[model samples]
Target: MQRTDVNTLGEFGLIDHLTENFVNKQQTTILGVGDDAAIIAGGDEQIVISTDMLVEGIHFDFTYTPLKHLGYKAVVVNLSDIAAMNARPEQITVSIALSNRFSVEALDELYAGIAAACKTYGVDLVGGDTTSSNKGLIISITAIGRAPAGRITRRSGAKVGDLICITGNLGAAYLGLQLLEREKAVFKDNPEMQPKMGEHAPYLLQRQLRPEARTDMVDTFAKEGIVPTSMIDISDGLASEIFHICKASGVGAIIEESGVPIHNDAQLQALEFNLDPITTALSGGEDYELLFTIDPKDTEKIRFLPDLYIAGEIVAKEDGVKLHTKGGNIHPIKAQGWNHFGE
Candidate 1:
């Protein structure tokens, strides 16, 4: 028997391997995999469904993370996935597993965040399940959304000459996570000391603890009459996501280092940690921004849209994924983004 190490497969590789045998037989299943969400055929509009899971120690740590924020984040991440499909989120089902360490009050606090997120996004919390767990807290959320015909985008639609783009700034969330982990370590050593995060990086901390989905960007696209050729949310780092688009679309990309978005605070924080800001923006995950591609003709309209930046352009698959550095150097783009499996 060939015993293969899972880490060698990575997250996307493992998923592809596992789902290879499973075929979608139903006519209603318009999409089954290879994208951010599965699209089901609806009468007038397609229904997009996506799910995300957060394990206590792996995805998040509760020591400094508020339960309410965790609940809110759990929903937002799914909503982000839905938005990546260019769908308007409608409803969600949440399931949780926790040990006896939690109380009714704690549950309420967590639900309060979920409720707040639902209210903010105008989605309904339809159903869910709860069970006891010997391990720490676990949250699984499934979000359903709808997209009008011809408006639904997928990772495989990008073509040569399509402009690569991303929404909002990047790298702050990764810095925030680093800062939080550092603070947690400090607290472990000295109980009386508090986390020394100043007002300088409030946005960073918020980006990590309470990320918002880019549903507003979807609205902007609708208003601007722009349907992306290809789309995927920046849940993983930019480089990893770029690789996903290239592989799915059978095209290569030219991402410029100068084009990657990084906020001022994130740059400062990166310097503080002696890390490269570009590296963080490229390899750091969990920013929840939208990375997409559009026809070159739409460049004028894209410029008018707020918070969207054209980061690169699509090329022939044989050309290979390359990054044009600020110093006029070109390097092969590698998927060094978040690997959920392991290094």
Candidate 2:
């Protein structure tokens, strides 16, 4: 038999390859795969379901990540998926697999964070499973949300001439991860040395450690009477998410370099690390901000929305995905975001 490597397909590719043969047997499964969340028919409203898993040493580093923050982040990431569907997350089920290394007090601290997230997001902690693992801790959370029939957005709704928009700033969380890893390496070399994250540490670290979902943006859309033509949360970098939206919607995009939102602190840190701010913003993952497209007719509706950036526009698929750089250069925008299978 021939051997094939999982890394060859990457994460999303591997998912597609594996699930290609599965057929949806239920009519309620409005969406099955290849989206932020699965949509199901539910009487007056649609039910949106999203699940995410975080593995120890892979998704997070305990050296810098607190249990409380980890719990909150685990929940937030899944809820972010729900938000991507332009839905309101109402419940979450958290399942954990941990080794004996964790103590009862540690579990309490972790649940405290989970409780905090539940309270903050107004979601209920429904039911979940717990089991033991020999390797390390693992958390899997499933978030359930609700959306009106016509208002639920998906990745496949973008159309040509639609305005591409993003919520909040990008790249800070990636820089925060870099900062934490750098500090961790320094500590590994010299235990007596303390981390010097400088002035930007708080903001950057907070972004990486405890990211909040843009569920409020869903509310903003409702208040403004703007239903995005398409939406996806920025989990896998702006460029990658753009690719997802484009591929799903059968359209292309033109991103303006100047319109990409990079926090002032993120810009400084990127330069300090000898990285391009725009490139960092493009490729850095885990922003958890929403990337969505709105009909051109609805442009005025989003004009006054807070913290929103009109970064680009939907175009004919033949145009491909290109970035109009501030330097008067236009080039293909590459999807160089997170690849779980990469070494």
Candidate 3:
């Protein structure tokens, strides 16, 4: 038997290679593989579909992450991708690959979270597949959303001079994971210690166990009569997401390092962990906040919003993406997206 290293083809290359060979037989597949969600033609509106796969151990640790919270997190992540497209999620198909180690009651608890998220988001579960797996549990969720004609946002729509806006705080989720892993290690060595997690209680834990998607922001933007020139969720951190918007939009950006938001607890935790809060905000994944570029005029409308921040302004292609540091140093903002494939 021959084994090929998956790393031989980088993430993008692999996606391009696999998707390139397949021809779209259905006209419904309006777009695929390259963006946040695959666009499908639909009646009176465009349908957006996004799928996310989470593998136990690789994507999460069942020991610390409860089954119910994991279930909700999985759906939220997928829905976050849909929200990145400024689409309203209407339905979902959840597929699970599980081992016999999980009890029927355990599965019930997982679905309870899923059911809760569905009700909270107003999405219906249409269909899915359940299969056996020899390894850890695997959950794949495909979320379907809808948007009116010309309302759907894509990564390719950014233009020079567009204002880059990010919703909610950043770095908390990454720091949250760091805190959990550190505590888990401590607990393993001293079982009697009872976990000395003081200030880093709920926020960090909630971030790791149950990060919420900003679908409400999507709805708000729509009501405010503004369409993001381009958008991508901050799942892969601010730096990587900014790069995605830049590359797709064929523009550049100058994001203010100071303007990037970081929660107080996240900041304190990062300091205690000896991690730079800015770096964590830059490269940390799974924040699930929406990072988008809007027309300069729209900036005025949202500038006063509490959670949203005008972190940067898009620049010309030649300028390239960069960050303006606190001391006034301009440095290139590199792509530090999640390297799950280790490219």
Candidate 4:
């Protein structure tokens, strides 16, 4: 008998391998896997469901990550997936496994954050499970959203000549993580030393600890009468999400280096850390921005969209996924983004 390692398949591959044999038999099951969220038919509307798990140490560190922010973020990340499907997230179920280390007051603080997120997003907590764990805290949230049959978007709908667009700036959350790790290391070395996060700490830390889903974009799309040909939220990175869209849609993409949105603060921080700003934007994960492709005819519709960047265009698969560099260079874009199995 041979023993197989999970790392060899990677996260997505492992999922594919495990679920490859299963078949969806229900008529309501419109989508089952290989997408930001699963879709179910519901008469005139489609229900979008997405679940995410966050484990301590792996996804976050307690030294810097507040319990409240963690609770809020856990929910937001799941909602982002629903938004990627162009749906409205109306409810969520939060299940948690925790050890005896947490006190009642601590749980209160955590729930307070979750409640705040629910209030802010106009969602309901609904129901979930709470159990004891032997190790660290783990949070699993399942977001439930709905959209009209015609408005439900999928990753497989992109076509050649579609305009690739992105919401908000990239790389700031990654930089914020880097900054927190630096401070954590410094604090570990000198117990008396305070963390030096600098003046830009607020924005960077907020981006990292409490990223907002692009749910507003769904409303914008409704208002503007524009439907994306394809869409995916950027949880991994810009490059990796582009690869996902390309693979799903059977199309290639040409990303313009100059068009990728990078914040000034992130640029400064990247330079301070001896890293390329563009590389950070391309490969640094956890930004939670929306990456979508729209029909070329819809270009004028997104022109006045706040914080939207026309970063690239969909192309024939034969062209291959490549990046047009600012230095007049063309290079095949690699998915050097977050690897869940990599240590």
TM-score of 2: 0.88
* C-alpha lDDT (0 to 100) for residue 118 of candidate 1: 81
Question: Per-residue lDDT tens digits of candidate 1, residues 1-343?
Answer: 3445444555556445433433444444566556655555566878888998889888988887999999999999999999999988877777788766766557667888887888888876655666678988999999988888789989999999999999999999999999898888999999999679866469999999999999998899998889999999998899999999999999999998888889999999999999999899989999999999999999998886778899999999999999999999999978988877753
- Which predicted model would earn the best lDDT? 2
TM-score of each: 0.87, 0.88, 0.86, 0.87
Summed backbone clashes in each candidate are 0, 0, 0, 0
Give all candidates' CA lDDT scores.
0.85, 0.86, 0.81, 0.85
- Worst ten in a row by lDDT for model 1: 17-26
List pairs with backbone clashes in candidate 1: none
Which lDDT tens digits does candidate 2 get at residues 322-342?
999999899999877877664
Candidate 3 lDDT, tens digit per residue, 223-283?
Answer: 7888989999998889898888888888999999888988889888888888888888899
Q: What value does the lDDT take at residue 331 in candidate 1?
A: 93
Pick by lDDT: 3 or 4, better one: 4
Evaluate model 3: give its TM-score: 0.86
Ranking by TM-score: 2, 4, 1, 3
| Candidate 3: regions farther than 4 A off | 1-42
Which pairs of residues clash in candidate 4, taking residues 3 or more apart in a chain or in different chains?
Answer: none
